[model samples]
Target: MKLTESNALARVAAYCSKAERCEYDVRKKLLGWELTEEEQQRIIERLRKEKFLDERRFVQSFVKDKIRFNKWGKAKISFELRKKKIPADIINECLGELDESELDESLRKILETKNKSIKAQNDYERKTKLIRFALSRGFSMDQVLKTLTGIIGNTDEEYF
Candidate 1:
């Protein structure tokens, strides 16, 4: 059904209320409805004024959900938030909420589980594969190396 301005506003408001929404997300939805630029801007302003849309809130929720449910590392989470057009300061602020020790522990768990499933010719190959896997999951090389060192008990091994 074609949505009138008022109806579109109501629908967008409901959509925003159902979850945290950034301005970009709301604007995209408005555009999908074929609203004019003026109408889109007005609706966006209304949503912001009514507290139905908040970029910071969206960032926080998005970060928390991705970390807790998806087990995503900071790098991956930051990349996804950037893709959503969240500001860098806001992304940093949201990412700051993640505890360092918790993140390390989570990475440790992931590596341990992955190590068990992987079969390689030698310890060198295994360590190399583990590092590659962690890196692919968006963890920094430094963190992955440190975590591997702690888990594997020797950093001197060439495969690190």
Candidate 2:
């Protein structure tokens, strides 16, 4: 079925209204509809004007969702936003909204749960595995080590 510009615009508007949408998402959807560049731009402009497509809003919602529901770390969230073609300033602004203490607490909670599930050979091995796991999860290596140190208790040997 062929969609006229008006029809496409309406469809895209409806799509954006359903949830927070970045310009990248809307552009991809319009492109899939076989809209020309001009048509796509028109629809995108209208969506932006109508408050349907907002990068800031999208970034905020994305960060909140990934952190609260997915338990993703700042690095992962930033990477995903970049993949969405969000501007660096907006990404930084949204990331700034996340409180450091809150993030650390969240990481601590996740680490505690992960630690319970893993059975390592010794304190060193456990700390090593935990650090690796947190790093894989996109957490800062330094922060993870610090939290691990607090949770696992300090030993004579250094674990980095």
Best by TM-score: 2
Which ranges in model 1 have alpha carbons more than 4 Å from their true place? none
What is the RMSD, in Å, between candidate 1 and the native fold over all Cα? 1.6
Top candidate, metric lDDT: 2
Indicate the worst ten consecutive residues by lDDT in candidate 1. 151-160
User: Tens digits of per-residue lDDT for model 1 on 57-84?
Assistant: 8888887787667767899999988888
CA lDDT, every model vs. true structure: 0.86, 0.86
Candidate 2: where is the Cα deviation over 4 Å?
155-157
Expressed as tens digits, the lDDT of each residue in 50-150 for candidate 2 is 89988999999998888787878899899989998999999998898888887788889999999999999888888888888888777998788778878
Q: Give the per-residue Cα lDDT of candidate 1 at 98.
A: 79
Q: Looking at model 2, which ten-residue stretch has the lowest summed lDDT?
A: 151-160
